[model samples]
Target: MRYVSLGSGSKGNATLLEHQGRSLLIDCGFSRKTLLQRLELARADAGQLEAVLVTHEHGDHAKGALALCEALDIPLYCSQGTAIKMDWTEHARWRSLTGGDLTRVAGMSVAAVTVPHDAREPLQFVVEAAGLRVGVLSDLGSLTPHVIAAYQGCHGLQLEANHDPEMLRKGPYPPGLQARVAGPYGHLSNAQCAELIRRIDWPGVQYLTAGHISEKNNHPDLVGQALALAFGSTSRPVHLLAQDQVADWCEF
Candidate 1:
């Protein structure tokens, strides 16, 4: 299996996973045009996308899901709460995904793990194909035991490192916004994200993409330091996803 991140950040987020010529899009946060351009840059074809899976209703995660699916004549899957929150009352191509249910989509087994976020019903995905697992985890403030257990044995992982707590506390965001960001339902700090990496079966992770980084409150250097701390003497290739560019493909 191989994956490419179209982008990852507060502005927008999307990931494309492919195996054996079949592809799945995790989110379509960018407009159709922008997403298509990114796909082109990555040498990927939208026509190959079998489905689009939405994590939540947040604009940065779900803004262009419907449009993309409609344009491609592909199905979309999301939690029922997410559908209601987005006001997608009815759509012929929409499929409801229940967290914890292993469903087959696009020839892959998708495990939707519920997460604690501000959205009505947020979910992160761990997709398996050809005996390999690739996990897409982000947008949660805290990592529960369930989350950790679900991500075990992943060959590829894209985990969020949203901010540096010290930077966030001293940054330009207002007090209320800061409180929300630091709250239990907001985003994970660099330390928190590293802790999750530590708690998980990191030794088995072959590809690690540290993503969903806050442009204003976090730096790639800090994320690197945190990852180094988490992995200790262990070595692995780490990719830091930027908001404006398509990341290099990671194949496992």
Candidate 2:
């Protein structure tokens, strides 16, 4: 199995996972043109995608899912609440999935895990194929025990390091917005992200990618420091995802 980030950050987010000649897209935050361009960067084409999975209804996550799926005549998978929030009922290609539900698509098994976010019934995912597991987690405010359990034993994992708490406190965002971001239902702080990696089943993970960064409140150096603290003395590979470009593929 192999995976690559099409883009990751506030402006948009998407990832492509390929296994056994089949490709599955996780999220479609960009327009058709932009998505196509990013796909080309990874040496893939729209015709190769068997389905698109959405994690939530946020614009940066679900914005282009329906249109792209409709245009390509591919199935769109998401929580029932996410589908309703996006008003995707009219589309015949929409496939509803509830949190904790496992389904197969594009020759891969996907398990949706519910997450706590401002959006209605948001979810993250754990995907598996050929006995290999990869977890895609982002946009959740806090980590729950369920999340930790769901993400265990991943061959690869993409976790969000959205912001630095100190920077967020003094940053440009107003107090209310800051509170929301630092709140229990908002994005994870660098410290919290570090804590999560410390508590998860880290030894089994071969590849670790940090993503969905806040350009204004977090720096790559800060994220690196946070990860370094959590992964002391370990040589497991780590990759940082960028918002503007496609990332190099990580194959296992």
Candidate 3:
């Protein structure tokens, strides 16, 4: 299996995963033109997308989903709440998915995992194909036991380390905004991310990509350092997905 991140941050987010002659996009937050360009960088064709999976209805994650699926004539999968939250009557192909059910999309086995987020029915995904497993986890405020179990044996992981707690506390965000971000239903902090990594079974996680970093409140170095401590002396490679640059393709 192979994967690449088109981009990851508060601005937007998308990921491309391919294996066993099938390709899938985890999110489609970029513009159609930018999405095409990023796919081209990975030598992938947008017309070949098997499915588009949405985690939530947040603009940075769901903004371009309809446009991309409509343009490619591909099916979109998300929770009923998410579908209802969308202007789905305007689109023809959409499938509502519930957590814990396994579905095949473009030859890949996709299992949706519920996540705690501000959205009504947000979900993360665990994808398996060609004897490899990839976990896509983001936009969650906290990790549930179900989330940890879902990602227990992933070969490649794109996990969120959205911000630094201290930075968030001392940063310039207003009181209400800060409360929302630091609340139980907000994004994860660097320390929380590191603790989660420490608890997970990491033997199968050969590649780790920290994603959805805060451009204003967190530094890539902080994320790297925290993860490095959690992954001390382990051979696994940890990468930070940039907000602008597309991550290099990695295979497992």
Candidate 4:
């Protein structure tokens, strides 16, 4: 299995995960042109994409989904609530998935797990292919027991380390916005992500990628520190996906 992040941040986000000759995109936050260019860079033909999975209806995640699907003529998969929020009923190729249900598309098995977030129906995905499991988790305020269970034993993981609590508190966001971000329904803090990592079974995680960092509130060094602490004295490799540049292919 191999995965690459086209980009990750508030500006835009997209991730490509592939295995056994099948490819899937986790989000379509980039412009159509930008997405196409990144796909080419990864040596992927846009028409070969098996499916596009949406985590939520947020602009930075779902903004370009419809356009991408329309252009590529690919099927889109998302929670029923998220479909409604995206008004995907109007699109013929959109498919609705409920949390806890397993579905197959293009020979890939995908399972959605519900997460705490402000979106209509938000979910993180655990995808299986070629006897390998890859988990894509982001935009969650906190991790739940269900999340831990779903993400356990993943061979690769794209986990969000969205912000630093102190940086956010002292940063430039307004009081209300700050409250929302630090609230139980907003993004995860650096410490929260570290705690979640400690709870998960990590021996099977061959690749760990930190994503969705806040440009104003969090730095790559802060996220690296937190993860290093959680993965102390371990030889497992970690990569911080850049918000502006595409990440190199991670193959296993």
Candidate 5:
């Protein structure tokens, strides 16, 4: 399995996962033109996408999903809440799955795990193919026991490190915005993200990508430092996803 991040941040969020000739797009947050450009940079052909899995209805995650799927003539999967939020009329191409149900997409067995995000019925995905598994956890306020168990044993992980608490505390966001960001259903602080990495099966992971970092509240250096703190002396290669460019492919 190989994965490439098109971009990951407040500006936009998308990832492409491939195995053999099949490909799955985790999100399409950017505009169609921009998504195509990024996919080109990632060396991914959008035509190979078998399906698109949306994490939630947030604009930065789902904004371009339908357009891309329509252009590719592929299916788009999301929770019922997300579908309703989209108000999509293209019922034939939409697949709605409840959390915990497994489905096959592009030769991978996919299971959606409900997550604590501000969006209605948000979900994270764990996809497995040919004995290799990849877990994607992002846009969540807090990490729960369910998150840990669901994400354990992943070969590749894209976890959210949205902000540095100190940066957020001193950042320009107003009081209400700060509270929302730090709230239980907001986003993961760097410290919280590191703690979650510590408790999960990190050693088993072959690749770690700290994703959805805030340009205003978090630094890429801080993300690495925090993750290092979590792994202690047992450090592993970490990849940082950027909002403006595609990340290098991580294969397992």
Candidate 6:
């Protein structure tokens, strides 16, 4: 299996997970044009995409899902709460998945795990194929036992390191925005991210990608330091996602 980040940041975020000759899009935060261009760059034809699995109704996570799914004649799989919030009932290409429900598609099995975020019924995912598992987790607040269980033993994982508390406290944003970011329903702090990684079981993971970074309150250096604390060393391979361009495929 392979995963490619179309982009990852506050501006937009999308990822393509491909396995067994089938391509599945995890999210569609980008505009149609941008996502299609990134798909081409990743060597995945947009016309051949199997489905769009939405995590939440946030614009940076799923703003483009319905349009892309409609354009490509594919299904949009998401929770009932997310569907209700989106209010896109027409055309009837929806696949409703409840929390903790497991479904198989394109030779890969996907399980939805609920997440604590400022959404109606947000969810993250774990995809398993050919004895390997990969977790896609982001836009979450505090990590819970369920999150740890869902993300454990991943062959490849994408985790969010959204910001540094110190930087955010001193950044340009107002007090309310800062409070929202630091709240339990907001993004995770650097320390929280590092600690969560240390708590998970991921010995055989080939790649660990940090994503959904704050352009203002975080830096690559901070993310590296946090990762070092998580692994207790600097020898482990890690990839940092960006908002401007698509990332190369990380295969496992």
All predictions: root-mean-square deviation over Cα?
1.1, 1.1, 1.3, 1.2, 1.3, 1.2
Model 2 weakest 10-residue run by lDDT = 229-238
Cα lDDT of model 6 by residue, 1-252, tens digit: 888899999988998888878888898998878899889888887766899999999999889998898888899998888988999644498999888999996778999999898898998899989888889999888988888878888988888999999999999999999988888889988788888888884568777888998999999889978887786555566688999878989887
**Stretches > 4 Å off in candidate 1:** 232-234
Candidate 4, residue 99: the lDDT equals: 90
Write model 5 residue lDDT over 125-159, tens digit each, in one string.
99999999999889889878998899888888888
* lDDT (10s digit) by residue, model 1, range 1-252: 899999999999999999888899998899989999999999997788999999999998899999998999999999999999988859887899988989888889999999888889999999999999999999998888889999988988899999998999899999999988878889999888888888885566788898999988999999988887785626785679999989999987
Off by over 4 Å in 3: none
Relative to the true structure, candidate 5 reaches a TM of 0.97
Best model per lDDT: 1
Q: Please provide TM-scores, in order, for all candidate models, with all chains considered together.
A: 0.97, 0.97, 0.96, 0.96, 0.97, 0.96
Candidate with more favorable, higher lDDT: 2 or 6: 2
lDDT of 6 at 157: 82
Cα-based lDDT for every prediction: 0.90, 0.89, 0.86, 0.86, 0.89, 0.87
Model 4: per-residue lDDT, tens digit, 1-252? 788999999889999987777788999988878888988887876776878999899888988988888888889988888888888876887988889979886677889889998899898888888789888888888778888888888888889899999999899999998888888888888888888788884687788888999999999899999987876526876689887788998889
> Model 1 has how many clashing residue pairs?
0
Q: Which ten residues in a row have the lowest lDDT in candidate 1?
A: 229-238
Checking candidate 4 for backbone clashes, the offending pairs are: none
Model 5 stretches with alpha carbons more than 4 Å out: 232-235
Of the candidates numbered 2 and 5, which has the greater TM-score value?
A: 2
Worst 10 residues of 6 by lDDT: 229-238
Q: Across residues 53-118, which tens digit of lDDT does each residue of candidate 2 receive? A: 999999999998888888889999998888889998667999989998999999999999998889
| Model 6, TM vs. native | 0.96
Least accurate 10 contiguous residues by lDDT in model 5: 228-237
